[model samples]
Target: SQLSFINVQNRGNFRWPYDGLYQDEDGTLSGVVGGIVLSPDGLWSTSTTCTQTPNFLNAKTCPSSVGRWVRYAFNNANLAPNGEALFIYDTSNHYTIVLNLKKRLTHPDGYMMDLLTRQSYLFQFNGANSSVNLSYTGVVYDLVPGDYLIIRHNIDYIPDRVYTTSSSILAASSNTPLTAT
Candidate 1:
């Protein structure tokens, strides 16, 4: 899908099939903001751009105020090599999936690993921002050969969500082809 949104309510996982996924706005759920990629065991990542805030609300357990809030720019600069990207839960303690930019053969779809359960989930969006529309397949699919672009909007509302859309000349490559998905 070109653009999609999946509501993550009462859940700690999120996934975007073929695009960059991000939080809807600068809005925070229970005082948490932005998203981050985690290791398979929900421990660490190679990315140095992500910021961690202690004592942040755990959207999974909001109102109770438990867990840390991780922040990262949903752009190429903060792009992860290959891992699940997570955003702060919404006001109702759910997550919503949004669009993002670029994808690679090695890194095709996005996956979410529950920190508490460590259960991996594969998800897709219905392009609607409603809670009932989203669903998980309970299976991870193989990567398809195509030029998929996951474009996360350069949202500046949240200080941590600020990202640049500009591309670096040295990093820019004309070899990558954009295949219609």
Candidate 2:
């Protein structure tokens, strides 16, 4: 019997996790992209009807126990993922794109729009006191304000090592946990 290797592809429009600079068509430094910073602000609710799904369980659905969400919005310009008016931190020219999922403070259920790819990411935070802060936390998903995603990058200096990619379910059969730092 002959064994063959299959090239697995992503099912949905999920963004590849990587913290780096996006370049323009002319190969110009387009700045950093896909940088999420989860704040330990608010608190996770203790609702029986809700359960938090581990970051490893990417496909599993939960009862909406993950309370609070944070949103970072970017312009819908014909630019790269981390184009201008977005996250541009440090002189090292390196960053890590992470999706940290854990029990944390109150965040608003929000959305992020990728201007380059014209893709939007929806996120929800199931908290007992979770409320959307339109002014400070950007626009809410339910409001349908517009189409966009937020990748915030704020740093003075780049770290020694920037995380680019991780083992996804497609790449690795095992359930690999993908979280933000």
Best by TM-score: 2
Best by lDDT: 1
Worst 10 residues of 2 by lDDT: 27-36
**Residue 95 error for model 1, in Å?**
1.2
Candidates in order, TM-scores: namely 0.18, 0.19
lDDT of 2 by residue, 80-102 (tens): 23322222221233322222222
After the best TM-score superposition of candidate 1, give how far the Cα of residue 60 lies from its true spot, in angstroms. 14
Cα lDDT for residue 47, model 2? 23
Counting only residues 3 or more apart in sequence or on different chains, how many pairs clash (N, Cα, C under 3 Å) in candidate 1? Answer: 14
Q: What tens-digit string does per-residue lDDT give for candidate 1 at 1-181?
A: 1222356443233232322222312324223333332221222222134333223222121211222322222222233343233442322333444343335323344332222211222223333232232222222222233312232222223332222233322333343332333
Runs in model 2 lying further than 4 Å from the true structure: 1-58, 68-72, 76-153, 157-181
Off by over 4 Å in 1: 1-92, 98-100, 108-124, 128-181
